[model samples]
Target: MKKRLTWAAAIAAAALSGCALAPGPSLDSKRMHDDLGAPTDTTVYDVKLITPQLIYALKQADEADAATKQASLSTQALPAESADYRVGPDDVLGIYVYDHPELTRGASGNAGNDMSPLVDIGTLQASGGLGGVLPQQISALGTNGQGEVDTSGQRVAANGTIFFPTLGRVHVDGMSTQQIAALLTRRLGSQIKNPQVDVRVMQFRSQRIQVTGDVKNPGQLSLTGSALRVVDAINRAGGGNPDADLQRVLVTRGNRVMTIDVNNILNRGDLRQNIALQSGDIVHVPDHTQNRVFVFGEVPKPQTVFMNQGRLSLADALAAAGSIDTMNANPRQVLVIRHPNPPLAQLDGTQGTVQEGLKKVSYAPEYNKPEVLRLDMTQVDSMMLATQFDMKPLDVVYVGTAPVSRFNRVLTEIMPTAQSMFMLWSIARNR
Candidate 1:
């Protein structure tokens, strides 16, 4: 009878497994949306300069050292006025004399020491020959054909060399105003009594630097007496936009090109990369390229998202992508397609742990002791469960349906006992 009962139980179990429950609405099985609108091979990965591991290492390395690094980065020499000055062609000069009135040129006329009307030496003639100095009539008081002083100034051919009465031809080109004035004073000391001279730039016409790229207003800015820095040029060009890549600023002077990290210099005070600009230098700020990731399919709001740090993980990326749509999301079947190489190593390691655990279980005693099974999904949760593991720049994640095989087995086991009980109740009622 026991044998017959066991046979009956085994046959009932088999029959129940094959029996199809009336396919009413299948509430037991999870409904998965296969029409998840075309499978997209698109993903967004953040580009990070410093890896999380590296950041952790840095944090671990500097418990107290962080303060020192911060101080060092913040401590920069106050930006002093730059003294490196260059005299370019066409820059105007104003020569003056302190006590010696006969040696200076004021705004009005060449009073006692002042020279005649302002000389507009039309752009300097660097190309030398004979008539290199383009002659223009200068109205100055001088002895006419007869060696006599004329009170009324008359237009005369002022030789390129403004004969400062005694001083000879003094080439102004390439020489600074101070150098020219000192030379003139030394020469006049031989003829005039105490000669005091001063030199100043009255106007700046030629000195210009080109400013270009990603600026509101870009053009040539003239450098006057005050020195110009990288920031000054940027300011002149109406500054950069909020999204400008200040770190990639470029300064090209003639044949040489210098890259300046303006962001670092401004924020961290790293002056090592802050370069001095020169005349004719081109300051360029190229447009920043869009670095972003497109997130779609099973997300709350499927759209493209940008990252400043340039890198994101599967879990973190999902969060940024507005996370899985809880209504349609199957969290267990989250599929992350990554590069087939590097991720394999990580997968192997994880699989190794899993395999070792399985092997240990296979050899474990039949005694059922309460064993703690810790599934660490929170830490390193970015890693996917399958073979091709490490995610690349762009990867597609497909969240699938829940595993229904085990649930089906549970139903199969319970249905037979319930059916037998119902049949027995019907027979008892008939009796």
Candidate 2:
């Protein structure tokens, strides 16, 4: 034990021979952040300066994103409303063939031996129940004048076919109502002269979108005859929860996953993000637990701060972290390290390098792959600008250490070892 202590002491003495062992660059904050400067009032500023270009670049990127999303929705996602809705299994189809009252007689309302009556949805609802439902609301939820359900209306079998008086069990899966009517018309042409046939979908029960995760009411939302958008579905589900991260709403359709910025629609009224939701789409509004900004460096309390609906500013983040350490913090050279959206780590299936992933927003784009947004909190103009300058998710707000504080830190690192070595030297000489 004595030998081991002696060896350990010798090793410590040799290790402490260096004047200091402080990590990080000794360069002052100003020198380190040479590219960043005060916010410019004019539109035309030096391209070399980083902060001014950020707002414009971010605006451009947002527009590009919105356009891309809109294009995807318009071209690929949104189904054409003008086209007739194809009848599927469980759908209530009202069929009538003119001159043959026998074929149309039993199919007026939900009164049939083979099928069950459509349950009153409004009765099942918690709020008003069956008593609270308005006549119009009931009409909307159930079949209205548009296509009133028939008593003898045939329910499509699980096999996707319905039995008509003369047609027997016909495969009407993926066939539009008009097409089905024309098929019946042509097939019955042999028996009757000009068989005027009409077919309409009374109840749309086959298609539904599921709403899960942080929402007031999470369940399957039935898709009606009319087209439903993301907003409409959310509203029907009793809106998002208080902690819901509406900015990063996830819509999973089969294998494809889409991130929707629903915050834009509710706040800025950006209609583009409110894309039409198709049947079987699962909308999951995640909580704000992951949507946060980190405050570090010379902040009094360096911690994660949750952003309410993605509206956190530099000032807000600072305030949440108990404000900056004014004594040691270089307020003039504050840095906000912003990682790319969906971060480079989590690729959005896009083929791009680290630099390209950043979306070209900052002056530090060359050396710093992730943007380093600088803000001079010392300046009144700059500080005011920081209020308007929104902080995105995963932004690292760093109040650079003061030059004097950096020097003090180096002294602090070496002082304890220096004192120990001096005491040892005195002890050996006195012995």
Candidate 3:
């Protein structure tokens, strides 16, 4: 009997080793939960469901804070009256002198003059000469008998001044063309008898604004009339592309950049984000590429969901993944793995105090440490909590399998092997 037992034990050990080394489909149960990597440096947090009133209050606070920030950054106030387009350096101005045709180069008399068509005012002034600058620009006004503009318009110099015949240097920066014409008329009064000066901005080359990224026609937009609002520039560029994220549309001014949610303005009637863009403002509508959240485990479709309109609630993400399995999913063990770091809230999305949310749920303060938060979907009001929970980029949502289902799975896997072993034992005994 001892020898028989020893032989059976030896055979069983050899069989187990052979199966371990076998190159074939694994007999082990295949499930997503099986590949859940070992947990390391994880802090678990439970869902905190607040009253509807509290949620409303929190939203109000966030909106107010956003409004205040928007107002402070919008340096130029919305114009009460139609704002005049101010001239800047490098703008081309068409100067016309009535009756005194000789004052302008375009006049028939000056056609043969030894002057280039476009005379740079700044260059002429630097050379300690005033005669050439005026003829170069004003000659266009006094055309030859054919009534054609011979000279190019006067270009505003870098120093915001334009040189006229006798009027050495006149500052025109930030002044309207009409304002410039009036000033020139007064200055040219002594030189030319009753000088009637007429200034017309031929080409608005100064206020060049860039509206790029995600627009159908992205390029430089010239700010011609009244101050161009953020929306006007967007419209001028043929609006945002289909995949453009209206939320978090960036407006870059000099060193500072501000993101505005156009969706909020359209849906929630939040007009604070519609800023009057100044010169040098670059409007960029980014493509909705990075807006995604991962969902795995017991869901019918464990996949990544793109955040629609720069926002995806917890419920939305779960729904996008086809929701948790009703039969075998642990509703209490829905895990959200997130890492706390950096400038807190995103530029435009569901606004929430990161510190407050993390602290309220007792999350780890260390940014490097990953936090494993448990959202109990079993509760009746859990959906409300999910609505308030906004999904961030790269957030992983995992639904755990029910304990009983796991046990049944294990049992199903072992029962076949157990039956085979019993059959082998009986065969050996019979032999």
Compute each candidate's TM-score over C-alphas: 0.45, 0.69, 0.69
Record all residue pairs in model 2 with backbone atoms less than 3 Å apart, i.e. clashing.
106-152, 107-152, 108-150, 108-151, 109-150, 109-151
Model with the higher lDDT, candidate 1 or 3: 3
Tens-digit per-residue lDDT, 259-288, candidate 1: 565776678776655545556778888654
Residue 96 C-alpha lDDT in model 3: 68
Q: Over the stretch 1-431, how does candidate 2's per-residue lDDT look in tens digits?
A: 56555755775676676535557667556657565577654533222222646766876897796686667756665556544666788877877665464565223444232234444444445344332333444333333235553354678899999887776888887788899889998999998887877776666767779999999989987665566788888888899888999988878777666778898888998887687777789998899887898898898899999998778988899889888897899977778777655442333444334322113222323322466667876665776677767888788888888999999999999998798867765655454
Decoy 2 TM-score against native:
0.69
Query: Candidate 2: where are CA atoms >4 Å away?
Result: 1-50, 97-101, 105-152, 189-197, 341-344, 347-368, 420-431
lDDT of 3: 0.70
TM for candidate 3 is 0.69
Better of 1 and 3 by TM-score: 3
* Backbone-clash count (model 1): 15
Scored by lDDT, model 1 comes in at 0.49
For residue 189, give model 3's deviation from the true position in Å. 1.8
lDDT of each: 0.49, 0.70, 0.70
